[model samples]
Target chain A: MKYNYLNGKLTIYLEEELDMNSCKIIRGVIDGYIMKFQPYELVLDLSDVKFMDSSGIGLILGRYNLIRLLDSKMKVINASKNIKRMIELSNINLECVQYE
Target chain B: MNENYIKIESKSRSENIASIRVGITSFLSTINIHFDELMDIKTALSEAVSNAIDHGYGQEDTESIVTVEAWIRDEEKIIIKVIDYGKGIEDIALATTPAYTSKPENEHAGMGFTIMESFMDEVIIDSKINEGTIITLTKTIKKRKSNSKKVE
Candidate 1:
């Protein structure tokens, strides 16, 4: 995971598989960035992600809730067709997060 | 064609998830299933194996073994079983319910079984408390009227 912060907007590029193991590693790093930057907006870039199971949903929803608690906004961008399909099947009300 | 079987046994480690999925995917690739169909199966298989590693063995017990066995029968039906010898699921109905994770602190959405159920044609779970859990997933490949693999 790589993140860039500019003008109160932070974008993180996610890559590879997002399963239980990778999610654990990612959550820690992202949370660290969130705490340090405290950016008003958080954007998750998923263009490089090749595989994601339900754990990816947890990662997104968890970050959504986390950012919301900090009075920040979060959006998921560039999700692959298959990744979007997995999120749709979950049906978790992620209204706060945007997908593009 | 006769039935083809492949079994993968590995320790319950989170790192092994990728290789296990790749192994199963490679095994199934000998057939003519569509790309999306293969993706669905791979996702379902990942959920089953993740459940075994995360919930079944508690992620800390890497010494235990998780077994994955897949077989293709009748050239169209594929059946896979993910087995783990860790703490079994106490309630089958509740576990399968969407958004029910035992580890809420870990941001677990608890959609493992649900994902498996939706992607695969049928997901049959057999578990015993303090024993283990065996998840059997089955899907029949769609017969294409044309040579193109795209479903739409």
Candidate 2:
């Protein structure tokens, strides 16, 4: 639920559990930020995610699609091994998603 | 091989997920389940609860209840059952298939069952179209050689 913009890149530090609950709250607010800042390269930091489900995948994909609409790219950062497995077992399209 | 059990019934609300996580994680942590194993259980629990709230009640009926039962069968085994008395899936086989979800529009990748299967040693989904669904997840915790029953 937090983001930092530096050097024209937006890095979002998600320190919350990326479950259905956080997704709901995040979905409500992301658009506002997109409209306001309109950053092209976005990084999602999930180092502090306590728990994640399929909804977490949806959140990333939804944001990916959203940023895609803006002709931007979304890169992932600090994804745990379990989160990586979740994303890999999810939709094949997301298999190409990068993590750092 | 000491026995411990906990049963939790909560309204099908997303907010309650936190409490469920805290409860389960706290209990299992006391049993010396490793951090990664705890993460696996928490992830599976979230998926199960999410299924109950989203697929079961369609995330609308706050009156409906989601039941979670956890049984520590022994030092090395844990069983959890997540049950929902909401609309159940007609095809269990198809439902368990990878990338199969009725709520793709909502960004569900149909990885709930996939996740539960990966994290737990066994996952059994029992459902009937009108009755309800019960997903039983069993994980075998890696046995740590310790006679200390109390978490100190």
Candidate 3:
């Protein structure tokens, strides 16, 4: 639910369930950080996220698109097995980050 | 009355979605189902709830209610039902099309039905315009092999 920027990277720390309700806030925060920092890389830290739905997938894909536009790299870290499976099922690269 | 059936009713808002996943997981676990199968069920449940909130409830008010029911029949079939009373879909066929979203501005890919279909054994949708939508999903657990088969 909270996002921060540091060391040329935008780190989004998510808590609770990441679904349709939270996706709007997530998108807004990510967009604001991307525009303000213009970081060369965007890192999503999901250690605190207990659950994620397809809307969560949409959030990731939307950020991926934004990163592509800015010529930056995007990675997700600390995804649970459930989250990882959802990401993989969506055809996104599973090796893009080190799972914790 | 089956002892394995589980029911959860919460606001159609996104915050209550975890209840759906928890409900499915508990039902699956009681039957000794594996984690992978549970994840598949969780994914399908997530999609159904998302559709209920985003499409059914229009994702505007968090006060709307969404109901989810899960149960296992004869220790073989898992049935999950997600119901929402919202604007409802006038065209069920058009609404379920992959990559077709009513709210494209939110970057919705409209793959909820597709994901549900891919994960569950069968999907049934019942809805009436301006009334509500009910999504029923059924999945059968595959028997586990006792022999260990290692893959390279």
* Candidate 3 residue runs with Cα over 4 Å from true position: A1-16, A45-50, A77-100, B1-3, B143-152
> lDDT tens string, model 1, B105-144?
8788888988898899999999998899999999999843
Please give the DockQ score of every candidate, comma-separated.
0.83, 0.79, 0.39
Top DockQ hit = 1
Q: Answer with 1 or 3, whichever has the higher TM-score.
A: 1
lDDT of 2 at B119: 83
Clashes of each: 0, 0, 1
Which residue pairs show collisions in model 1?
A: none
Arrange candidates, best lDDT first.
1, 2, 3
Candidate 2: residue A6 Cα off by (Å) = 4.4
What i-RMS does every model get?
Answer: 0.7, 1.2, 2.1
DockQ of 1: 0.83
TM-score of each: 0.94, 0.89, 0.80
Off by over 4 Å in 2: A94-100, B143-152
CAPRI level of candidate 1? high
Chain B TM-score against the true chain B, each candidate:
0.93, 0.90, 0.88
User: Share of real contacts kept by model 1?
Assistant: 0.77
Q: Per-residue lDDT for B37-143 in model 2, tens only?
A: 88888898888998899988987788889999988876668988999999998888888898888887777768888889988899988998878999999988884
User: Evaluated against the true chain A, what TM-score does chain A of model 3 have?
Assistant: 0.88
